[model samples]
Target: MYDESVVPVKMESFSGVAAKSPISQCIKTVLGRARVEKRLTIGLLPAIQYLSKNTNGALFCLTAAAPPGDSATHMQEVLLQAFCAENDIYVIKVDSEQKLKKLLGFSETRMDFSCILVHYPYTDPFSDSQEFDTSVLSEAENDLIEHCETNWDYAQMPVIKLPEK
Candidate 1:
């Protein structure tokens, strides 16, 4: 069973953590909800006893090979945030690439980007791919349209920048 305390946290709630741009606030809101909901879904103590560890599922992200503080990485994160804002997927800029890689089960030696997806998973038609179901995506789009008001232009949104180390 996953420890609730170990659940991934957003930058705002993480003590001593701060972000240099407004984009972090948006990222914090989305990731924070996901993290909290994930723990609540898993329940605690005896409730956890009935469910198998695997049934708890996993959080998926569409990460790139970007690292924070690098100019290229900053642009990559901003573009990523715009995309996520468009699709309603949560996005975050992680400074600790090594930490995220390790958490994603990769060896510590292998470093990778930390911008990841928090979308719900569904079965894909391809045997080798994990693409989202089209219907599901469409439904999500409709839901987003119904409930969310968004501005597609990145300038209109709170642009994300790298946090100071």
Candidate 2:
């Protein structure tokens, strides 16, 4: 089981934004887009592997806060954070793994997922396989990027904390 002692980093603490802030909305939208486009990498090992091999996209990572005293989960969280930090990826921490799974449209009995990696590839005009127009997503991404630039300290790992339910 995941530990319960990990403290949540509140969004307001870093960005002064509430739970319903535009940043949160953008995140939801981006996640939806990534899901529809099949650009999301779920689970810790898959995410790590994807990040290790792919560098062609704008990457965003979302992780559930590790339960306190769950050394394995905590270690996974730390390792993921370090990898993201080294790669200049944005990492957002949500309240729990179940909530995150629900947000991703998984059924209640599905395997628990602690981490999700969303990859938004740089648009390729010449590719016929690009079915969806991503202009709206682009706008949301720009907003998120601007928010991060304005509010977060880039020197440290960019981990936006979502309020707990």
Candidate 3:
């Protein structure tokens, strides 16, 4: 059982771009039961943060770009948690981007996480914002890593255009 964060670190996210959620959704759609120790968030804006609990979990990162902010960060986390509860997926939240990176690089291949969510992505790190829109990333497309030999009948979709009044 690979316990390490399994999620990737700084995989080329932009100041205005996002990746984590799209990848999470992809894995959720692709692996389903096999997907474990997941990490995800849906910031206050239309953006989201996501991290799968495996080395190959990031195969579905960043389908499109969304707005940014700590509120967005908080919202993302809430949405992710709700999603996991509904699906019975194990998830963790990291507040500091740096801490999040550390877990991703955790030497232990398998270990138990303190909390289902880590609010700090980093210990004494810098910023935790996006540089670009996640939509530009390749993982945004139809690329779900083969963790389990199964398929998800109904996987979540990246936020495309918002609703109109």
Candidate 4:
């Protein structure tokens, strides 16, 4: 039941020693920073809930391509994409779920996640502590924002579709 009309997006692999794209590298850096800051919202349901509850935070969402034949999962991704679009949240589609898990340092655990929402550092007026240093993350975020704004239209969601077996 493969749909020939739906073209799959080009997927990038991070396993080999190949040179990574600037956008990809920025994404990795953002994810790493978010992880260290404990700002990641893992899994589909949790991400949805987080998005629903928080409307004024800087957010980035990463989703992996759904495996072939999993219509339910594919539909869920589509839904998430639509929701993100409406909320102005940036969505990054990775090559695979396994790669995402590895990037988030969850490969050693039994947990599985296809979607991760990163909460970027933001200034809080009421906080007394010094702000977290986010120079690297800021640079990466700026690059990613530039790429997305210049290369793609706002209406187009860059969700990667897994190829058929």
Candidate maximizing TM-score = 4
lDDT of 2 by residue, 1-165 (tens): 422333222233133434233555566667777888888888887887887786444367788777688899789788977778667677776656875666677846666578888887547768876343445355556556555555456554344433232
Per-model TM-score, in order, reads: 0.35, 0.68, 0.24, 0.71
What lDDT score goes with residue 85 in model 1?
51
Tens-place lDDT per residue, model 3, 1-165, is 422333332232333354444334443332222222233322222222233433222322222222265465445556654554454333323233323223344434333221233121122225354232334323422233221112222254222221111
Q: Please identify which of the two predictions, 2 or 4, would achieve the higher TM-score against the true structure.
A: 4
Q: What is the lDDT, from 0 to 100, of the residue 111 in candidate 1? A: 32
Regions of candidate 2 where Cα sits further than 4 Å from its true position: 1-21, 56-58, 125-137, 154-165
Candidate 3 ranges beyond 4 A from true positions: 1-69, 105-165
Candidate 4 stretches greater than 4 Å from native? 1-21, 125-137, 154-165
TM-score of 2: 0.68
What TM-score quantifies how close candidate 3 is to the native fold? 0.24
Best model number under lDDT: 4
lDDT of 4 by residue, 20-104 (tens): 3345566777777878888888888788787777754546778887779989988988998788867777777766777667777
lDDT for every model?
Answer: 0.37, 0.64, 0.32, 0.65
Report the Cα lDDT for candidate 3.
0.32
